[model samples]
Target: MRAALAALLLAMPAAAQTGDLVATDALRVCADPANLPFSNDRGEGFENRIATLLARALDRKLDYVFFPQVQGFVRNTLRAGRCDLVMGTVAGDELMQNTNPYYHTTYVIAYRRDRPVPERLDDPAMKSLRLGAIARTPPIDLLLRNGLIGNARFFPLAVDTRHESPGADLMQAVADGELDAALVWGPIAGYQAKVKGLPIALRALPTEAGVARMDFFITMGIRAQEPEWRRRINTAIRDHQGEIDAILRDYGVPLLDAEGRLQPP
Candidate 1:
């Protein structure tokens, strides 16, 4: 029986490569070709830079499969074996298992600098202020849950107004004085607002549990069955911290510490 089991184990296709990862060949990465500062096939995104570093560490070439950043990208690529790993992913995203977060991001309130900053999201002073937010977005949901505003006054149409590119519009509205403020992804929002000199102040809001915030770190996703691959990826993250930091820095994505404060690049 022991001999039979040993034979079976030997015959099984290796779920993930094992042993010294430095000797490994290539890391198949799933990425989006057009997304900036993330995974893109043009070899310009942060995820792409990190992928290159990881490949070098493992002594492997990188095999990137580009796809749009849309629903089912994970299922169709990484899950279906078209790619071995996802370059980056939200930690608690419902799609796949993730490794320890290599970095965290902040979601800040971007408002006209001339306007009064609310002490908190529920502050009474904000009661009459028009805040632009993306429809079906987490921030919008948080606002609704907090009873921050009525459905009619939200913007770009109304509180229920969803847009394919709401973040861009939301920032533009704030710049144009169409809205007093908007809650958006910190890195992207901060970058755009700063580049445009929109005269906006990006402030981190105090958030309650379960809402995505600067305090929570995001992680990289890997195939669940590939424990060895996951370990190598995590190891690469630790070993290439400086390179990763630089990549994010170049893209204007602030690296946040455990307390959610921006850290020095």
Candidate 2:
């Protein structure tokens, strides 16, 4: 009887052996422990929520390899094989295989509610206000082209890996009266302004020249060798796009449709 059973199992299709051949263990994700709106150690960010949803769809437990999202982040975590996936990355990033873009967003202007918020880069009001931006970011170049660089306060883009995100600091400055306005990434600014309850206004920028094109499509990052894994993830993303969009909405992400209109959740 045992010999007959072994022969029967071996004769079954390859698909029938998928459970034994493929590992459905934990989904090990690489994330920043302190990057809010994306991820954090406390699992309060949108990326954390997305990770959870993906793991559930794959019928696997969720786990994280926490690292700061500074220089050498990929080398130390994903490339080092400490984790099998990164939940959030630019779609065209060359460092790893990327899944289909899950969301698109643009840079935003953040300012205290008590002050005037300029909807466009050329607003006359921008010239009189104290502008702030992260160094080397697209917004800085916009400021330069507009002749606003001389008065703009620049925050460093690269900080010690141990430090908190400088993006948060720039947003906080707008809320704390340190800056009249700030140009920051849309998701971060939206999360800070709407979700985090900061007293600031967040507005999307209108398309303009020399603005470094603030928009971007974000995707999940996987190792080059993980083509099958990437396909699975892409399937998951496609299957659960509605749920994913809801998660982004809950986190106050400024989502944009293909036509560039604001997609209200």
Candidate 3:
């Protein structure tokens, strides 16, 4: 029976095998080709810079299997064997085993410097503002629970960000006086505000009673079968801490410490 099982396992597809999935010649990355601040075909995003660091540390050529970050992204890229790693994923996501978290961030509400928003989502002031939040993200729940969704605008997620940056656009709306405030992911809001020089201000959403999580730890994703590879990459992350932090800093990512305080430049 042991011999039969060994033979059966060996006959199964390579991806199903419990083995080191790291490629010998390259760091094959699964990335969205047009997702700015995260990745793109032009290799211009922070994840691309991190991918280069990882490839160098592993002594492998960097290669990317470009795909849009749409439904079935993992199924089409990593699990389909087009690549061996995803550069960024929310830690604890059920779809992939995660590496040690590299960064912590939170949702932030952005508005024009002159237009103030309620610090807490449950504030009664929220109900009066013309707010915008992504349709399916955490803010929507808070927006609804506080009865603030009446005048709130909902933007769709998973668009080709190269063509449509809903988060940045919403921030722009705030700066242009089209909207009162917009709650969005921190990195996008910070990066866009800096790069675009929008007259917008951002405030991190603190943890609140009876509210959904506003913060997340981000990690690289690996196949559940690739524990060894995960360790190797984790070591790479430790070895390149300064470079990684600098890359994120360059991209204007809003980083938070374990206690949820913002990191200063």
Candidate 4:
């Protein structure tokens, strides 16, 4: 019976093969309904705005397939034929073909304004401060390498998307004095720090030897079989680079150049 079931499942067409990119009137975007600075149901995240722009450029109405961006996000949404695009993803994801990079950002430090900020992982002051960062993140590895892990508080890398933003929680802890400082993703740290009215200073961490590169280029993700669709998305990204930069700036994303210097709007 198990072999028969397995054979039946094998006969089912793969999602991508079942649905080709068709000329549609609505641009279907897959997004996290609660993740801010990236996406949300209210269309307030930078990726939301970018999706809108992309839809408009393509002369299609904007629509979204809202889901929590957690484990199996790509498989359950994009690969399940529920949406046509993911507005923001790592540039070189192995699960899907990626468009040309739209923006680059890095990990950042979030600390209370009144407290001394440790600009680098190797700062001597960090040895004494109670640092916080998401567990399994690049920053945590850096902390461990520099012997700062002993004093660090680690949060879960994947939180329940239903009720938590780990980055925001870490920043709030900093503001409330429970933590001396926190290392968080640049976009989330900057947006949360400003929007939550926390008296915090956000600074992008510079790349250093022995630390994994903190910077990453972001791009749109499309099904690997949809080359024409990927090309269209890339064209839209290239045509609206200036507008996309503006949206990212509004969200306080720490845009950086290849040389690691901050980019101005």
Question: Evaluated with TM-score, which candidate comes out highest?
Answer: 3
| Residue range with the least summed lDDT across 10 consecutive positions in model 1 | 155-164
- How does model 1 fare in lDDT? 0.69
TM-score of 1: 0.78
Backbone clash pairs for candidate 2 read none
Give a tens-digit lDDT track for model 4, residues 1-265: 9999987787654534434654367899999998887888998788899999999999999989998888899999888888889877888899888989999999988888898675667778778889899998888777878898899998887876669878778888998999998888888887876655678887777667877888899988888767667777889999999999888888788899878787763
Report the alpha-carbon TM-score of model 4 versus the true structure.
Answer: 0.88
Q: In candidate 1, what are the lDDT values of residues 21-63, reduced to their tens digit?
A: 2224578888877665465557976788888888888788888
lDDT agreement of model 2 with the native = 0.83
Residue 59: error of model 4 in Å? 0.4
Order of candidates by TM-score, top first? 3, 4, 2, 1
Error of 2 at 209 (Å): 4.3
- Total backbone collisions, model 1: 2
Give the root-mean-square deviation of each candidate in angstroms.
Answer: 5.1, 4.2, 4.4, 7.8
Residue pairs in collision within model 1: 25-60, 33-41
Segments in model 2 whose C-alpha atoms lie over 4 Å from true places = 1-24, 160-162, 207-211
| lDDT (0 to 1) per candidate | 0.69, 0.83, 0.84, 0.83
lDDT of 3 by residue, 1-265 (tens): 9999998887664544435556778899999988787889999889999999999999999999998888899999888877888987998989888999888888988888876777777777777889888888987767777788897988888787658877767777888898998889988888787766788788887767687899899999988887667788899998898899889988878899878988874
For model 3, how big is the CA root-mean-square deviation? 4.4
Q: Score residue 132 of candidate 1 by CA lDDT.
A: 70
TM-score of each candidate structure, all chains considered together: 0.78, 0.87, 0.89, 0.88
Quote the lDDT for 134 in model 4. Answer: 92
Model 3 spans > 4 angstroms off: 1-21
